[model samples]
Target: MSRIGKHPVPVPQGVQVQLAGQTLTAKGPKGELKLTIVEDLDVTLADGKITVKPRQVTRRARSMWGMQRTLVNNLVKGVKDGYSEELEINGVGLRAAMQGKNLQLNMGFSHEVIYPIPAGIEIKVEKPTSIKISGADKQLVGKVAADIRSVKPPEPYKGKGIKYASETILRKEGKKK
Candidate 1:
């Protein structure tokens, strides 16, 4: 059996959780999220607690079971408190600004790099080098962050690029001949 999958997910107050057929829905103050459960997985809901079980105790089944449980847990947490990621630009003429719901980035490009923020996600650009992205869905927040980082990943040479607030970019010595 899966250790994490066997545990119970405690539901907080002011939140509603429902398990219908192959779908699991969670509603909270932030927003609502619905997930379709896969086969061979059993989900139990009652009295503010959710539990996950697998049809078989095989290794693969156990892995899936834990992942499913984590997904459900994220859904519940996201709809309640939500999630966010912050990115900082480090380079000359590299800055971010908000154009309505889209991000305008001038990362050494001749033209601005326009990026549209997806639904359920919010992007904010402060004065110079900070960009804040928030959402009620974890996956969406991560995707948006990844897209932004891809524009200009931190280089080991000068560490001049965009990177997560919590990320560390190691620097390499300049070539001297």
Candidate 2:
């Protein structure tokens, strides 16, 4: 039995959820999102809650039960409250800025790195070293943040690069004398 799958996801007030065939759609103040449920599991909505269960007694079905339920939960929460990811630029002279609808990054490269902002996703550079990415889709928001960080991932030695705001770099010892 999947522990997470056993708990139904509650649809909060002001949020509307609909299930059609294998697709689940949620609409709320933030935005509207849709998810295609896996065939190995059964999903249902009742009394303002969404539940997931395995269709058969099998390893794959059991494994997908909890994950599918979490995905449904994410859709509900995403439409209601949205999601955001923060990044921190560490190192001297490394910074970020917004130019029109694009993100400009300065990470010791010869040419400035220009990243075009995607539709439905907002990127804000509160400070030159701090960035905040927000969107109604949790996956998109996280992917955008990861792409930004991948441009100049933090190094272990000097920790001079871009990283998540809540992430801690494991510094390595410098060259011995």
Candidate 3:
């Protein structure tokens, strides 16, 4: 049995959740999101709560039950409050800025790297070293952040590169002469 799947997801006020066949749609003040549930699970919405259950007593159904439930929950929360991730740039001469609508990054590269902002996603640069990525779709927000971070992932030696604000890099001892 999946612990998370057993719990019902409560729908908050100002949010609407709908289920049609294997598809689920959630609309809220922030935005709207849709997801196609796996066939092994069944989802129903009633009394402002969404419940997910396995369609059969098989291993496959049980395996997908909890994951499907979480997907639905994420859709609801994403439409209602959205998701965000923060990135921090480290190293000398490493910084970020907005060039019109695109993100301009200077991470010790000979050429400045420019990333075009995607639709429905917002990027805000507070300080040159800090960046905030937000969007209603949790997956997209996280993907964009990962794309940006991949440009110059933090090196273990000096911890110099782009990294998540909450991430901690382990330091390795350098060569002993």
Alpha-carbon TM-score of each model against the true structure: 0.95, 0.95, 0.95
- Looking at candidate 3, what is the lDDT of residue 159? 96
lDDT of each: 0.89, 0.93, 0.93
lDDT of 3 by residue, 1-177 (tens): 999999999999989888889999899988888899888888888889999999899999998888888888888888889999999999999999999999999988899999999998999999999999999998899999999999999999999999999999998999999
Q: Cα miss at 120, model 2 (Å)?
A: 2.4
Which lDDT tens digits does candidate 2 get at residues 1-177?
Answer: 999999999999999999998999999998888999988988889999998988898999999998899889898898889999999999999999999999999999999999999887989899999999998898899999999999999999999999999999999999998
> Candidate 2, clashing residue pairs?
none
In candidate 3, which residue ranges exceed 4 Å CA deviation? none
| C-alpha positional error of residue 156 in candidate 1 after TM-score superposition, expressed in Å | 1.0
- TM-score of candidate 2 on Cα atoms, chains taken together: 0.95
Q: Cα miss at 100, model 1 (Å)?
A: 1.7
What are the RMSD figures for all models against the true structure? 1.2, 1.1, 1.2
The regions of model 2 sitting more than 4 angstroms off are none
Candidate 1 segments exceeding 4 Å error: none
Per-residue alpha-carbon lDDT of model 1 for 1-177, expressed as tens digits? Answer: 667877888899888998898799999998999998778788889878998888776777777898999999999999989999999999988998888878899999788999988889988887679998888899999999999999999999988889999999888899899
By lDDT, is 1 or 3 better? 3
